[model samples]
Every structure is written in C-alpha cells, then in structure tokens.
Target: MTINVIGIGLDGVVGLNESVRQIVERATVLVGSDRHLRYFPNHSAEIIVLEDILETIVEIRQHLDTPNSCIVVLTSGDPLFFGLGRLLVTHFPPEKLRFYPHLSSVQLAFSRLKIPWQDAKIISVHGRSMDELIQALQQGVEKIAVLTDHTHTPKAIASLLLALDLPIDYHFWVCENIGSEDERVQQWSIDEAKQEIFAPLNVVVLLRQSRIATNQSLDLANLPWLGIPDSYFCTYDDRPGLMTKREIRVLILAELGLQPGQIIWDIGAGSGSVSVEIARLFSDSTVYAIEKTAAGTSLIEENCRRFQTNNVVSIHGNAPDILHHLRPPHRIFIGGSSGKLRNILGVCGMRMLPGGIIVLAFTSLENLHTALSWVEERKKSDRSWNYRLLQVQLSRSIPIANLTRFTPLNPVNIMIISR
Candidate 1:
C-alpha cells in the first residue's frame, strides 16, 4: 500500500495537476485540513478531517491491516515547505511513500517578485526564535523570504525589523491572500511596514537595501560586522587583532574539525575568538575556552558576549594545573602555553582518543620548536602524532587612491599537533 503526499499550491484546485488529482481519487482515506480537504470536487476516498496526528496514524494503520490501504495526505504549497510531509515521511518508509510536489510558497513569493531565489536565504520563523531570523538578516544575505505565523506575524516581523534599525531603503513586500481572489501584495519601507496591517496568513520578502549598515555601530545590535569598513575589528596596539580576521576565522573554524557530539578544549583562549566563533557556527557542540590572566579572561568574556554565543564555557583557571581536572576532551587547542608544554601535551595527548585532534596556537619559533619536539617524542609511541603551524597574515580594506583596497593586516602563527 502506498502513501502519497501531494503538494497543494496557492492557486487552490486550479494549481493542482492531473496526476495528483488521481492519487486523491484513489486514496482509501484522505487526510488534510478542511480548507485543503475541500479541493477534491469529486472523489470516492473516505474524507477524514484531520485533528490529532496520532489518531490519523492509527486510522491509517487500521486500514493498512485490512487489505489494500492507500493513504493520501494533502498539504498546501509544497508539503516540504515547513509542512506536514516531513512528519509523514518519517513515520513511513520511503519505499512505501510517494510525493507529488507543487512549487513551494517561497518559490511563488520569489516568482511573483520576479526575483531569483537560488541565492536568496529562506527562513521560517513560524515557531522559531526571533534572534535566529534577525541574525540571518544581519549577515546581509542578498534576499530573504520568511514564512510567518500568527504570533510571529508580518506585523510582528515588521516591528522587530524596524527595532533592529533596518535600513530605510530596503523594500519589504508583504504577500497576502496569494493566488486568491482577494489577494493583496503591499510594498513598504521598514518604517512604513511596521504600521501596514495585513491578514494573518502572509509571507514576507526583504529585498537588498540600497545601502548597508554604513552608519550602524559595530556591536551586538548590528552583527556579522557586514558592510562595516575593515576598521571595525578591534586591534591591539602593535599586536595582531584579537580574533582571526573574518576570512581566516571562517576557514580555521572550519578546520577545528569537530565531529558530532564531540567535546573541544581551547587553552590560552585570548578573547575567546576561536571558541566563540566555533560555538556560533556549531551550536550543538560544547566548546571550552581556557584562560588564566586577568586581562585575557576579561577579553574572552567580552568576546563571548560580543559574538552572541551561548555555547562556550570560559574557564578562568591556568593550564596544565587545570588540564588534569578536565574530563578527557575529544579535541584540544593549546594557544601557545606559557610553560609545561611537555606536561600539558602529555596529559592532553593521553586524554584524546586515537584520532582526536590537538591544535596549538603558537607565534614564536622557539614555542613552535618546543611543541614539535614534544609531539615528536609522543609520536614514538603506538599513537600517531604530528604538528603544524598556521602562519596567518590577514588584511582589511581601507580607502586608498579614493578606492577601498585591502592592506596587509596582522600575521600570527598557529600550530596544530594532532594524532
């Protein structure tokens, strides 16, 4: 027996093709919301108004137990577009299910706007955190489409975006009653949209603003530091910037090389840059930022708050002395230890599993040699051990010859010793 989930579009029955209609007609029992259920102008399938999903599952199972049982679930506008298709697919194996999909509401929204959606960032804030949606927006993606909910309605989004100091030039297109007789599409600026009322059912599209956050301060309020001139990153006098430049940060964090449910230890965490960035990128992983110096500890905490990361634990204790007490971590990052290179590496080296990684952030050749010698000694054992240095040089943009050009920035040497 096959279970089919057909995608319904905003155009209602008119949008559905002939094949999907046949699945509905032959379905032993049909399941959908009343509005969706009414689409079958003529059908012999026993209409089952959906209420509790478990009840529907039980009803389907009962039908399946008898003989030939075919269940067809109908949804509006691409069942996979924040729809019930996922739930059904999870409950039934793929071999037993077939899906007929219509263009997703997001596709329709972008189509109606005559915009290419391939590059657009689509988010469903229906039952999600407003912060996530706002973060994605702050990253300055080219286009954004939001599937809104009653509590997270268009008005609510408009109001929140306005509070975020959304640019005045960016266009907000509120699509309502789409593919319906009473359909109304309203366009407004962020300020105007805050007051523009619309029905509960709506999709919101945010077009790229003519200008970026040129005037916004570099703070949590305005994130991803997008469009901010290269002058925004906080650089220490005569020293490299606290965090890896944005570009390097993205790459190395990619290489911290975490596995699912893995534990990571970041020693000598200065400003918690690596730790905070990793936490933000991999929200599910646990990151420990170890720092001892009063200034270093303060910097780490400040960065954690600055990056808006809730995943890192900033430990104010010193290393080696602190390494002994930690539950063996799967990954370790030693940020150029002040002393006890052998002792700390021995302890961390032993703590890690067979293939676990141990990264060392070192600057000076003396420190790098010391780290290499220690790892080399350990490599003599049954375990495999190796070390590397990340000679990172970063540059940022500045006005030169009346045009913004990247200048050679700071350089740092990061070493990775792993087995």
Candidate 2:
C-alpha cells in the first residue's frame, strides 16, 4: 500500500470531504506535524509527528512499496500550497498519490471575519519575508489575509507596518483556532493589536479601506509596481535594470485596481522597483517587499529612501515560508518565486480574500502554461477567477538605418485574477 497524503484546512476534519475524512479515519499509520496530528488525537489510527519531512518521506516510500502498510501524511492548509501532497507526487507517479483537500485556514479566517474574500490577496509568511507584502500595500490593495507561522505574529507584523508609516486607522482582525471550538476572533487598531497574544496557528485579515477619501497619485485600484524606473536609484546590475518593466507594470497596476492604504505583498522584490513605485503612487498605502537576495533588499531600501517614500518596508528572507508569517494583503503578487509556483498559488488561493485580486507575472511562455494549469485547478475549488493576457511591445528611438523602429520584444504574460 502506498502513502495517502491528506490536506487539512483550518476546519480540520469538520470541513474535509467525506472521502478524505474516511481516509484519515481508516488509516492504520498516520504521520503529520505535531500540530496537525493533535487535531485528531482521539482518532484510533496510529499517529506519528513528522519533524523531518525528508526522513519521513523516505520511510513512507519504503512502506509504500510494501504489501500492507497504510500510510497517511497530514498537512496544514492546502498540502499543495505549502503542504506535503506535492512533494509526495514528485517522488511517485500520480496514480500512487491521493490528495484530500479541505477549505484552507485562510478561508476559515475570512469566514470568521465575515468579509467577502473573493478579491483578497492571500499569502503565507511562515518562514519567508515581508518585502513583497509591503510593496503590495504601497500599491493600494484593499483587503488582505495572511497565513501566519509562529514568528510572523500580528505584533511583529504591526511593528513592521508602523515602521513603514501605513495608515494607523485600518482594521486588524487576528483569528485564532478558526473552525475549532476554542476559536477566538479579535478586531483592533494597529496600535491595539500589538498587545495581544495570538495563537501560533492563526490567520490575519487586514482591511486597507478605512476612511476611503484620501487623495493619492494613483487611484488605489490602479497602483503600479516598477512604475518608476530602477535608474531612479542604485542597483546591483546595469543591464536592463533590476525591476519589472514599466509598460507591463502599468498594465499590472491597472489590473490590480487597488484602493488607498490597502495591504499588498510584492514577493521576491529584486530592487524595490515595484515597492518604491507603489509607495510613490499610494503615499498613504503601506507596501511590503520580500527579498531574499542581500543586494535586492538593500536596493529596495535605497530606492525608497532616494524617492522619499516612507510607505515601503523590505524584509530579508524567502517566500511562502516568509510569506506565511506576514500579514495578509488585498493584493498579492509573486515578482520572484524561484520556481515554486504551486506552493505560491496554493498559499494565495488559501489566503486571498474572497473578492481579492491576485496577479502573477511570467516572462516566458512555458511558465505561462504552467501557471495557467495551476490557476485552472485553483478555479475548481475556489470561486470565479478571470484571466487576462497582455502582450506588450516597447521600443526606444535608436539609429537603425537612420530610422527608429518599434521592434517587438518577447511578449510577457500578466495573469490578473479575481476571486
């Protein structure tokens, strides 16, 4: 018998599909993280907390090749998002893996908050950084939901937002143990949220549209990243520039349709090109940048300072991991995800507000195909998701036979999503 990987959303067993629930209940050998296993501690199935997933995978594989072993791997939220189902599929064929997914924890958070989440930006900042999150806010995304780990507490998130000078009057909802009997939900001001104790396993919902009447450079909905050029500040390289293209960026911004002071995430910020422009466009908004590269993080700070925008905050870390720990956003974008597309979208789908918007930029067609496949799957369980294709061609005046021609560069794909 092969291993059966199960995805446990916020509701734990209560929200699981019948087949998935049956799989967990009937499993003779259950393996999960301590927290996940504890959710079903009373189950008669034998359980083991998997601390080292690599080691656990190896052991599970050995048993999978055996005759009578019933192995089940449990995960928090969507296993495909930051969960283990995908990992198992990598080592084995599709036929060898069975995935049972539940409504993600972020979904439960939204339900508890009673906010329509169709258009929210959802991200998991568990072990990743907040650079991207900051950038998104600067661009004016309105509603955001964050899947948090232990370190990315609401207080830590609040401190970061304060440092960035985001509007202090926005609403903050910290939901603990969503879908569980002891579930607790608290709403507070940015300052007030800093004093509370939030559960390690929790979710954050941020509402960026409080006063609704602040005037800014760009419409909160049309906030653009990388709108301002990289040459506006220092950079690690001197070629094309350490930033997303302005023309395409403008379209992405147009797609976002953000509001003033909305929460946003710019994951994998290379040079704060997106973050700075977002801050500049929405002076009242707070933008978070998640950059793992040292030069990139430094560049974000440098650019923000050079542009005199105080709404940008750069975090030095990776995504999904770092993303899980930060506050959620009304708009979420993956500027640089290091090829972790499945995990990225899973987190986004799980954490995005029901009515939130998500934008994914792809420079190549192959990746665009892959992203489409992933997004298509998300549309199945999730609500209505709309996709748009923007093929941009820009030209600069050059001495081409005494004439400047607008040579079409490779087409870039910008996928705008609405939940």
lDDT of 1 by residue, 170-220 (tens): 468998877777777778766676666788668899876533323334466
Mark the 10 consecutive residues where model 1 has the least summed lDDT: 229-238
Candidate 1 residue-wise lDDT at 315: 86
C-alpha RMSD values across all candidates: 17.3, 22.0
Superposed Cα deviation of residue 28, candidate 2 (Å): 3.0
Q: After superposition, how far is residue 335 of candidate 1 from its true place, in Å?
A: 21
Task: Record all residue pairs in model 1 with backbone atoms less than 3 Å apart, i.e. clashing.
Answer: 8-77, 390-414
Best by lDDT: 2
How close to the true structure is residue 320 of candidate 1, measured as C-alpha lDDT? Answer: 81
Error of 1 at 248 (Å): 24
Instruction: Report, for every candidate in turn, its global Cα lDDT versus the true structure.
Output: 0.68, 0.70
Model 1's alpha-carbon lDDT is: 0.68
